[model samples]
Target chain A: MSSLDLRNLKINVGGKPIVKDFSLTVPKGEVHALMGPNGSGKSTLAKALAGHEDYEIVGGEAFLNGQNILEMETDEISRAGLFMAFQYPSEIPGVSIANFIRAALTARLAENEELDAAQYYRRLYEKMDLLKIDRKFTARSVNEGFSGGEKKRCEILQMAMLQPQIAIMDETDSGLDIDALRIVSEGVNTMRGPNLGILLITHYQRLLEYIVPDRVHVMWDGRIVRSGGKNLALELEEKGYDWVKEEVAAV
Target chain B: MPATIEKETSSESIAIDRDIGNFKYKEDYSYDAGTGLSEKTVEYISNVKNEEEWVRDFRLKALKIFESKPTPTHWASKDLENIDYSKIRYYLSKGQQPSRTWDEVPDDVKETFERLGIPEQERKFLAGVEAQFDSEAAYSNMKTKLAEEGVIFVGSTEGLKEHPEIFRKFFGKVIPTGDNKFSALNSAVFSGGSFIYVPPGVHVKQPLQAYFRINAENFGQFERTLIIADEGSEVTYMEGCTAPKFETTTLHSAVVELVAMKGARIQYITVQNWSENVFNLVTKRGMAMEDATIKWIDCNIGSRLTMKYPGVILKGRGARGEVLSIALANDGQHQDTGAKMIHAANDTTSNIIAKSISVGTGRSSYRGLVQMPKHLKNCKNNTECDALLINTNSRTDTYPAINVRGDGNSVQHEASVSKVSAEQIFYMQQRGLSEAQAMSLAVNGFVNDLIREFPMEYSVELKRLIDLQMEGSVG
Candidate 1:
């Protein structure tokens, strides 16, 4: 089993501190919901943990199963079992989905080793079927001309294929409808097990109703200020974020 | 000056597995017109070919025209100044008619093509094969099924000797000697290129292949190619070139003229991987009649300096033309290529898509000319050129001359120069692809829309070549 542990993390973007002194840990078998309002710096935290170069870690310690990832390059961190599903995935025109994943898998192989086309496609079709993705989608350019729902689905498809130990889905529910949310949530839920730890970042409590998380943490002004069980998400949904802001102001 | 092939790869990781572009040259010249271009050199070439008096006179007139014209000074590259005309041998060949059978072909010539995989390719995908050594074709063969259907695939000399009735009608008419300085010189010393004539209503199912090899240094390979697709006929011709590296430079100046009669279609594809020391200057143009179509799909990967613009004239109602090209310029190379489209009739259409990659200090440019006169009603044209720079010092330029006088016509031009973005690389790398594979995929994707027009085999090899070019550029 693997885990994603972040301790006293401080992150800056373009010389401006966005996330400060944030600490959270999602163990191997559980999903943690990080709920925050806009400008809460959730994305900056996710990007920094994924080793994005722009997300400067002024002070932080991140580990993928005790392997320091803050010191590694973005790609190296990925190979070290960290994945971030983008809120707005980039469109790669003319590169088919099949080929993109194949390249990634090929990259992970030892030098001079090759991917077996037959077994690879067999596994791909199986996963595509599980996600209800059309067989023809594999031939289309990655995320090019895809709808919002389709983009999220494709991201899930990639996560399924890459099989990362810890996946931070940044706004995976953002722009998706109720039906699409159910499908994408189902795709992620199927992958949640002892081998996969998911950090579901969302602005709304609506997603947690479908894919319930083991714990909920409220992020405000960069760091997590409150922590509770699954009921915290429902309380935020009823009380709205202003209640938390007022509480923090009083404190 | 011995001709050798220098395979350049800065990183062992790139070529260690792919091992492409490892071509070598072996010379066996039986009729060497030696170094220097003069009336005597022209006369010696004509005598060796045993040409008729009229053809000899045509060569003399073209040579005189070539002498009178000055080198083109307005283009992007000035490497022409380095070509020592007096030191370049005009013609060299293994003295014999091109045999139809591979067994009769000279051993050196056969072995050279064997390395290049010509005969094997013929067996796999081609319907015809013409392998030219320096100045003359050493082997020319066509599938008997195509020959039975009146598809004539032969060397230019044989085309002149046997089909004078057809050859004389369109030899220099489309691209005459006075068209340009290079065309004039090619007309004077041209030899060994393919002469394809598809008769009315006959469609060649498979593409005809021609391989041009330059095996000697300080030599110029001037090959003239002419293709005529008669009414309602269709044909595709693919030509490949591989030259040897030498201390001194070589010149490959070719003139290709194509004519598509009413309702016919012609597709000409070129894959030029000349050595870095070769100056590849060429003039290629085609005329499309009523309801006819002409397409030029060209890929240029090697050479010190290349300046070529394959053009098409849409001369009749409803005619269509297209030029799809990709150029890769490595260090010490400049690829100056583009397309030309002229609309002379109503309802004519044309499109041009050119993509280029510049590595290190290499430079790539697109120069295009599109014209539609006022009288041509409802003529339309579209041109696009995109360039990718691989390094900080890599260079790219665009010069498009568009004159759309036709009030009822429309013209559109689009061009972009971009470096492969670090963000794009990161996106790919996040998926676990190495830097080289990511860059290679980006380059391939840049031209993939046009590359899809190539045959599957060609596209695969083109992808490999691009991978080789992209290697070592990024860590």
Candidate 2:
């Protein structure tokens, strides 16, 4: 029911061009994995799409369900049904995870409408269960004193609760052990539905083994150089990103 | 719902409190004793109260001291000079009996508390609640079970006259009249504050609450509070203050003295929300004896100017003291608050945590002092004061004085002043929260560490107040 359309996007950090002439789209009912090595501008693109102020959007027009999102504020973009699961979520002290998610959900409500706390808690507990997280996790401050795996799982929990139209997951598999990796991947797989579009950015193909993407794109030097089916992920994993760079240079 | 659409806009009406002055009670004081302070005023107050000779003499002596002392000159709250001692009515009371039931209270008085939800809160959480209207307490209630446990809770007047054996010993010993100019004034004309005495070895689980309101214009609300927790007993007392806006400035000067006997624990909490035209000058201190603990949890918001420093003196082995404070200053307001910890005995410890938020051109200052004399050994103190400025011109200042004269005493003081970063706000906004909500969340997060020191109901009320205060805090 929703679609993310990015046409020739450019992003700069600290006045230096990082993501140059990038273009990609993950339509509803599909999962697209953008795989690249370190410093390949994958994270920058994700942050810019979420309207992070630090990532100066140089030239880009992102449309979410036919709505122009480039001119909108960060919160406006979020309310328009765009989401980003950060690689390193901030640890807000004294703000419990329950309150944080509740605020996020409440922000989407109309001014006169009130949030149903009972139904909210019911859904929150259900999400926690689906993500294999303890109900006690809601009591702790968001990401405060949490383990690496715990933080990543919290991101998934937020995604489940928000249920945005398009979700950009940045390195959701990084910093996660084998056990946490599978659980996070399972959450993504279960979340893959016709009403949701996902762009899972990762450095490794192991994440794709759990939630196989419909399309695999290998990015090098801030641009996607190769695109193929899920088989491309296996080929890229067998050969390093250096092989993709060589293949692109040969052209 | 509190925000009103006012067609008239004045430059001075720029603060966030553009609409909220619903707290007003009809005034029909039978004994208004006119304005101005004199020996006759002191005699009139004592006479009205039917006080004993010693109490009357105490008032007269305090009045002299108050007259002799000068207003503080070098304080950050420059508005202190604006108080007109000559025009302030020293005493105003209705001469009505305090009712144990709400129906017996005057309609206007009951409605004021009802609007403030005092009765509901008391029924929900507190074991006892007392209310001070203008100059005297008009209502008091206590759960019979708690009263049966020898927990004495009454107004200062009744406490002094009825329980002299308990109140006489520790009344003036903690904070003497000569402590400060405002305390001297309070000692002279003080009335209608909570007087709580917990018998030895009895623990009062539910907190005792006091609600103080200023309903009469040009009337000075001076309430002297004395709380004594006997040996091995524990009690927590909380108070809330609210005043309506007046064309002329109002004055609220209170003195609170707390004594924690051997192995006793006492915690005192204050939440003050005064109108914009009020000057709140207060003096509060506590004394902790052998193996006792005393804590002051104070929050100051919505006053034109506030100058208060809650202190504690650790006087016995293993005695402990702490002061956790939160201050918020909006436009046309000055919040100058801090804490003091004095170590007087071996193995005594204390801690002070103060957090302040300044908006627009408002100013918030932290002035802390911790001292350990030479004779005190194995004493420790930790003082941390953090300030958050919401605007470019908002001001914050920290002045911490730590003096350690003994070999085994250690003191630590940490202070920081920071602004809410645009990046943090953006991060929160990206999660669909508005800019104002993001800012409020960040500010509340800063003081979240210290607010945990409060009771459950109080912390919830504080959070709601913060959210309401943050509605227009950011431009």
Candidate 3:
């Protein structure tokens, strides 16, 4: 029952429907891959689930661990254990990465409670060592001038520190090379456990080769038209996306 | 002077949005100049203080200059016309000389400084402290060790009375009365600011601080501060000001003069947080001699209109000047501030870095000047001004005039204006921060480089004040 369940979610951008009649359920202890071509409403679904103001959820019920998320504020939804790794992260010029992560974690604390700096740095250093990030990065501004690979790795580092129950990684492999992709996937795999549920949204099948998914769902025209096991990803990679469009049309 | 005009009770106290530095206690003043400015008013103040004959003549002369000069409106904001000189009480005092110990201060005055946490700060880090209420300092104290080392840290009144030789020589020398209209006005009716002088080769280990509090409505607080660092001496001086929120407008005008002798250095820092109904106009300038350095670190927030541009005149060979400033303008506020550096000597150098933030309908302007005359050789100047606008309605402007002549002199100027994009706010919000927190974080980040230049104690307090100003700024 610990899962993210979406029922008939409809989203609009600037009053134009972009996500129509979408439904998915990714239970805990599982990794689900949502793959589609460009402009297939994959990103829309991710943004709408994160409660972005621009992505209006006209009608839907998004429950995270049986609590409705649609009615909550953006930050409230985040504190409710839902993490969204952005495709293009913002550059906060003067905020160091260490401070940013500390603020995020501090937000999760109860009133009259303070964060322990020693323990926090210890865990942060451990995670950084695992991800191959230098210790000096803690002092640098967050994503101010980071390379694409470094930006993706920072996202994973944030995810590791936050320890969210559910995560939605949108195009995590868009601008990464083979080495960067491998490093990012390794960081993600370290957090994969029975307590975490991941919704990996990517267009290419190459990312699935690193962190294999339990299920593959093909989204077309705003809704999922095909669902199968992990091999469905390789099959779709072998057959072009046009084949899925034709198959959906014929059906 | 006319009979002491009773205070008109504010129909309703302006709702203060923040809990910090917004409370005021009832006023029971022993001397009030009764809501006007005239020769009689000036004479009344001089007579009450029993000032020297020369000082009294100086005040009369400055008063004539103040009346002759017109309000500066050629290029400044139109808000200058709103100040009615006849309606403002020129001075108010509790009539007690500045106490050397907090126990001797009146209860209400003591409670005011206690709430502002001034005495706590004095004990923790400051070597000397001065607390000014209205037109006179309620408490002024310096460590015995510093006073034993031939350092003089006292209120201006005592300095002028006891050490006339040094005080009179440099009182209005750095900033002459005719320098500007506000300077002339301040020279006529100034009171309650600090006077510090360090002997040759004596460096005060800790900073000396002054706190100015305006407790009454419809009053003008004109404080004149003068600091002279003797040859090879070093000192750091800091000041802070705040007033309560009221429906009517209040005025605060001050003139600060600094003199850094040969090989000496002086750092002057200020953080003023007047209520939104107060108009703060100040003139601060320093003179650096051969091989000397002068630096000004200023931050302005929580005022209706603030026009302060601290300047330094490099008058000797190899002198240096620097100004690092941060300003935040909230709704219905205008922060017009910048710096000025005049290189009158060979091989002089100056640097200016200013950052401002405009929230809601607030507007911030940076007007700077850097001049190197033809006679100066190998002089260098660098100026940078950056502005951040929070809402679409927020505004910012920059006006930098650089006049560099001669073959070896060089000048560099750069400016930028940016807005907090929706994406940046949303990005921080997704990390579990409220909209207001996110906005404050971004603003703090924008001024992070400059804030680091402040003293450690003040940097923390500055960040907290910024957070309070940003509480209701965002949706």
Candidate 4:
């Protein structure tokens, strides 16, 4: 009943049309993999859905649980149960991870409610332990001078803390080695449940071997051209995006 | 139909406090030295205080110097031309002796300090406290144990009358009366500042604090502070300043001097939050003897135009000097501040790090001077100045003069100007923070490292004030 539904979404970046006639539905309790090669507009869709000012939604209807999110602002969309894990997370110097997360959490509370420090730290430590992150990482500035793997892990850490209903992770597996990829996939799997829906965007089939999405959608140019089950990933891996390009051309 | 996620067990929200220190109270003063500046005004102040002939002569001579100097329009801001000396009330006081206890203080003055939370701060972490209202000190007190340990902390008026011998020795030695135009103005009608003297080998553990409050409209508060640390002594002194919002312009010109003897250490900290209609021009400097150390930590916020550059003269060999400062200039305000370091002896070292943020149309400038003569050997100096501009209309400037002419002496200067990037704000916005909150967080991060150098309580207060200033900075 609860889902992220996109119908005929049109997007433009800097007055240049990038995504035209895009549609998808990711229901609660399911993981959908949006697979595409370079410049297929996978990342643009994620940024536009999150209300980035640079990505202008020229024509679209994005509904999250029957509430249209295209009319909301960036922070409002976030507060309305949407989260985005960036491809290249920003480096905010001198702002500790603990304080940044705390500020974000504080923004969601009612006006007069005060945060309890003791319980917050206990839960933060629990999440950090679950992700195999060192406890000292909380005191360091957010994403400043972090390794590629560490930055991705920090993104997942925030996703776990914010606990949004629907999440769009763009290129979370890039720039990570094999061990890091396995660890990150484990963290994501640990957070998956009937209450959460994830739209995982990636260019590689290697990532699907770990997370094992229930559905896979292949994008071409600016639209989803093919859709199938988990084994379709194996078919695409065996052939390649070039084969899909030929198939779409024939259609 | 999104599922209800469990709430995080924390709840800390950013609240805006625009007028935390901008409130004021009215008081009927028994002594007012009328408006305008003249020899008669200076003489009237000295005659009322019953100062000796020598002090009165000193004030009269300094008044002449103040009259002779030009408005300094050539180098400083053009805003200096707007200050009308003839319209400002030079002196105001209740004419009551500074009470040693809060109960003995007059009711109105006591309520003013109480509203400012002076007594509460004094009880928590201060060794001594002095509360100055307008032109005179209302209350001055210290712990008995510190008094027994030979620590002298009292108002300047009492210091001049009771301990003339020691007070007169170094009163204007570090910063001379004719050093600058504002210094001359302060020397002519100075009142209500602290006078401290620490004996040899006496280490005052806690900080000695003084609170300067400006409550009168169109009034000038001139406070003179002199601190002398005898050989091998150490002391930390902090002073906070605030003024109420007034339609007319107010003037605050104070002169502070320090003398640190051989192997002595003196640390001075200042947090000034004047209203938008006040001009804060202050002269603060110190002298460091052989193996002595002097450090200044200054934070300037909420002033229309502030010109203060705390300096140190390394007179003896192996002396050290450092200055750490933070300045924030909001709409209709200008924060012009920096540091000066003079290395006169061999093996001397100095460090200066200044960070400023300019919001709206506010302007902030960093003006610095560092000199190491060719005669000095093995001297080192490091200077860093960073500025952050919040809006397109905001402005910042840096002027640094370094003159080091020795073979083995080394100097390093680094200056940077940055704007909070749009990408950074967008990244934070995706996490549910409003644009203003994100800007405040970014501004706080820019100055976070510098603020860690401040004391715990002051740092907390400074952060709250900064948050308040950034409230409407963005749409």
Q: Summarize candidate 1's per-residue lDDT along B230-343 as a digit string, tens digits.
A: 999999999999875677888999999999999999999999988789999999999999999999999999899999999999998999999999999998899999999988
| Model 3 Cα lDDT, one tens digit per residue, B1-475 | 1122223323223333354567777778899889889999898888878899998989889999999998898978899889988989988999749999999988888887887899999999999999999999999999999999999999998899989999999999999998888899999998879999999999998999999999898999999999999999999999999988888889999999999999999999999998898989999999999999999999999889999999999998999999999999999999999999999999999999999999999999999999999987999999999999999999999988888889999888889999899999888888998889889999989999888888899999899899888976765
lDDT of 3 at A227: 94
For model 3, how does the per-residue alpha-carbon lDDT over A1-251 read when each residue is reduced to its tens digit?
A: 76899999999999999888999999987899999999889999998888899999998789999989999988998999999999999999999999899989988999679999999999999999999999999898989999999999999999999998999999999999999999999999989999899999999999999999999999998899899999999999999799899999899
- Candidate 2: docking tier: medium
Q: TM-score of model 3 relative to the true fold?
A: 0.97
Best by TM-score: 3
Clashing pairs in 4: A115-B11
DockQ of each: 0.53, 0.52, 0.87, 0.82
Error of 1 at A76 (Å): 3.7
Candidate 1 deviant stretches above 4 angstroms? A7-10, A15-24, A37-40, A58-61, A70-72, A110-119, A218-227, A235-251, B1-19, B26-28, B244-248, B358-361, B387-395, B415-419
Model 4 reaches an interface RMSD of 0.6
Determine which window of 10 residues in candidate 3 chain A has minimal summed lDDT: A1-10
Tens digit per residue, CA lDDT, model 1, A1-251: 44898999999999999998999998988999999999999998988887778889999788899999987877788887788888988777778999888988887888779999999999999999999999999998988899999999999999999999889999999999999999999999888888989999999999998899999999999989899999999999999999999988899
CA lDDT, candidate 2, residue B34: 82
What's the fnat for candidate 2, on a 0 to 1 scale?
0.63
Q: Which residue pairs show collisions in model 3?
A: none
Candidate with the larger TM-score of 2 and 3: 3
Residues B203-250 of candidate 4 have per-residue lDDT tens digits of 999999999999888999999999999999999999999887788999
- Superposition TM-score, candidate 2 onto the true structure: 0.88
Q: Is candidate 2 or candidate 3 better by lDDT?
A: 3
